[model samples]
Target: MADRRARIVLVTLSDSFSSTIEAMAQDAALAIDRWTPEGDQSWPDATAAVWLLAGGEETAALDLLAELPTNGASVFVIGSSTDHRVAAALLKGGASDYFALPGDADVVRRTLDRLVQQEGERQAADSFADAERGSVGFASVIGESAAIRRVVEQAKRVARHDNVTILIEGETGTGKEVLARAIHYHGPRAAGPFVEVNCTAIPDNLIESELFGHERGSFTGAIAAKQGLFELAHGGTLLLDEIGHLPIELQAKLLRALETREIRRVGGTKTRAVDVRVMAATHVRLAQAVARGEFREDLFYRLNVVSLRVPPLRDREGDVELLAGRFVSDLATRHGLPTPALSPEVLSALRGHPWPGNVRELRNAIERALVLSPPGTLELEQLWLERDDIPAGDRAHSLLPFPAPLENIIRAAVAAMVELTRGNKSEAARMLGISRPRLQRWLSEDTNEPTDQ
Candidate 1:
């Protein structure tokens, strides 16, 4: 890749204009390569940060601009045409700036200065990406439940295939981005950037520019050429979070970019090649969105190349306690609080509460507890979770709540029956209308403690 800041290329028919352009390049301490085109369309081995297109027919100028060598170079089209459509067409063809010379010369100068200002952000973004490499992976998405393990297994398998588009579907706060990051940071492109953008966060009008940049003066306020997220995330992973919120109008463009690995800047005439792996994640079910005509079917299909659904917290049996403990440990350390023993009451309360907000809510509750607790203690009251965060069957009521898991109801019944029979397994089985061996098996599934046997 040529350094885009190296020099300027002039494609012009006016000798005087070319000489003046050469003088400006000299003023900027940049080398200039002038060409008359001469019916030849090739400019191979040319490296320039900016190209000047002057004095050509509309079709020819657009074609020439489209074929111009691009190593992240900006193109400026200058001519006397006052037709608004001509400038629009040139910009749509990827001209970074269309100056209706000779009155727009000052605007062009300002655009160049703006490009210089943007270079600083570009460098910082790239450096940030480099720093993120190797800082996260599958380990960061900590979970041992079979449900989570299954998702992790699939993510790991597909992580190496960075070119394959992936769709991650899950509820909010289910750590969808964490999984996406783990896949990217541990994948073959770990050395590349890991960029994430929330589709809903940007306004509808500006999202197009945010994702696909814009040519200078392409729109009313587009004073300078700007690189979009796709350009910034080149050669890495770009996670479009909450993708279902992406506007239907722009979905076609997204699909095209995904299908072609190329994106044209907003109001630009040329397509820029981007080598990036895309991961689209949404809390809203996209199929439902498609059915509602809110999301494009083709775009959904394109993004759903490899779909993975992260299970919600309630469905992930036996993971609540594990996650709660982990959150306590992590949050405590971060808040500079001493780690307190996770009491059986706290564990029981955590396991029984259905986490509607999922892992994120659990973590927040733990953080709240840590803050509300004394320097070395984590009391149940400080947790202040669900209205009835504590389970009912804690010797006071000992009544399993309604709509409890069938298995828990079954266990409660069996335990009650065995106690009613005074530990007589055979009698209890007969009363429950089940075989003694089955009763014993259920008990064993419940626990391996000596008392269960």
Candidate 2:
């Protein structure tokens, strides 16, 4: 068996500097092919390579970096200690790494090692076949409530096709990204990429290039070429999170791309065709935005091809208990300990309180509790809900006060059950041991009902 060797291209005008670089590279177990000043005449032939260029003037180093190939290869520059500026220029010029030579052997060796590892990973990623159903993997999206189950059913139905835009509407703290990943992994473009771009986090000035990509020298600071979400997510899914915050101008361009299935890089003459399913999510009400003329109506229609509303934790009946238990068990397993029990008081507190932050908040609370408390049962004190905040006794009641009697108590219980279950008369009747028609009559006769807020 032959030893696997790595190829390196060392370039420097000075022989001593070039020799030092070549020796250092060889010491790191990489084979070098030095390109002298005269041999540079055939620079075009030096195609397959990882370059190690000795530093020159900042402008010259940047020019050299720009001329290098765009494929997965790195450039390591060495020279004066002030080469930090040169390194910055190189990075802006699309160099994978920049370093001042004759410094730390261990750190330089690690940098080279990382470059080789990244190259290997990129090659492996490229070699993967772009089959729609290459693998069936699902993220941690667990829920069985009727509301959540219906949403999951809709997701499964939509995942069968590719390029169908989906709008996921949910309150903040709901796992919109988790559901998005689940859709992508199970969809026709599963083998492709699942790229996420947070529209709100990106600055207004940079949103365009971030979403659609940019060509080299596209702007003053854009010294290197950059691939945006749409290009990287080709044949896959692009999750535009917090999309409601996108500027009106960028929204117009996004709508155009959605309609045309192509995007022109920021300063490039050529338009590239892409096949990506756009799944956008927002805590804000997009319909209201359209009505207010804040969001474009055409773009709204384009993105809202299919809407899946993720139920908030408060509305997702019985899911709190299920999710809390699941989180506890998951946290226990992750910590390599026995699954702890949730006390009745803790369950009561969790169920009784309205989770304004939804499932996300719940997970955070649980994780915080687990981390703070020892491995025993998670206690009520570990959870952070103020006693006053719990909706223990504050519920809306009819204004007409009921007499403090047995009949009134029964009516209150039945009415409370009906309100708690969101006007499900049958469930109210079952809870009160009364017939459906009786409960219906009770609800219909709001005239005699007590009114108290």
Which candidate leads the pack in lDDT?
1
Q: Candidate 2: deviation at residue 216, Å? A: 1.7
Scored against the true structure, residue 22 in model 2 reaches a CA lDDT of 66
- Cα error of candidate 2 at position 43, Å: 22
Alpha-carbon shift of residue 211 in model 1 (angstroms): 2.3
* TM-score of candidate 2 to 2 decimals: 0.60
lDDT of 2 by residue, 1-453 (tens): 743445677666334356666666676666566554445454433223455455444466566655654243345555544545555566656554455555544555665564455445434554553432333233366777798888888888998878789999998878788788788888777767778887866779998999987754579986445567887787778999988989998898999899999887786645667889999999889999999988999999999999998889888888999999999998888987668889889899999989877887787668767876877767677676653343644543532246677666656666766664456577556544357776766655556554332
Cα lDDT, model 1, residue 439: 82
Worst 10 residues of 2 by lDDT: 129-138
Clashing pairs in 2: 397-452, 398-450, 398-451, 398-452, 399-450, 399-451, 399-452, 400-450, 400-451
Alpha carbon deviation, residue 352, candidate 2 (Å): 0.7
**lDDT tens digits, residues 1-453, model 1?**
745444566777444345555555565555566556675655534344555556445567787775666666667776767788988887777776677666676776665455444554555656765776545567777778899999999999999897999999999878899899889877888766778999976889999999998876679988767789998788788999989999999999999999999999887767888999999999999999999999999999999999999999998988888888788888888988898888899888888888877887777668767887897678887665543543555333435545798987787777755654457788667655467776886776566324443
Alpha-carbon RMSD, each predicted model: 15.4, 14.4
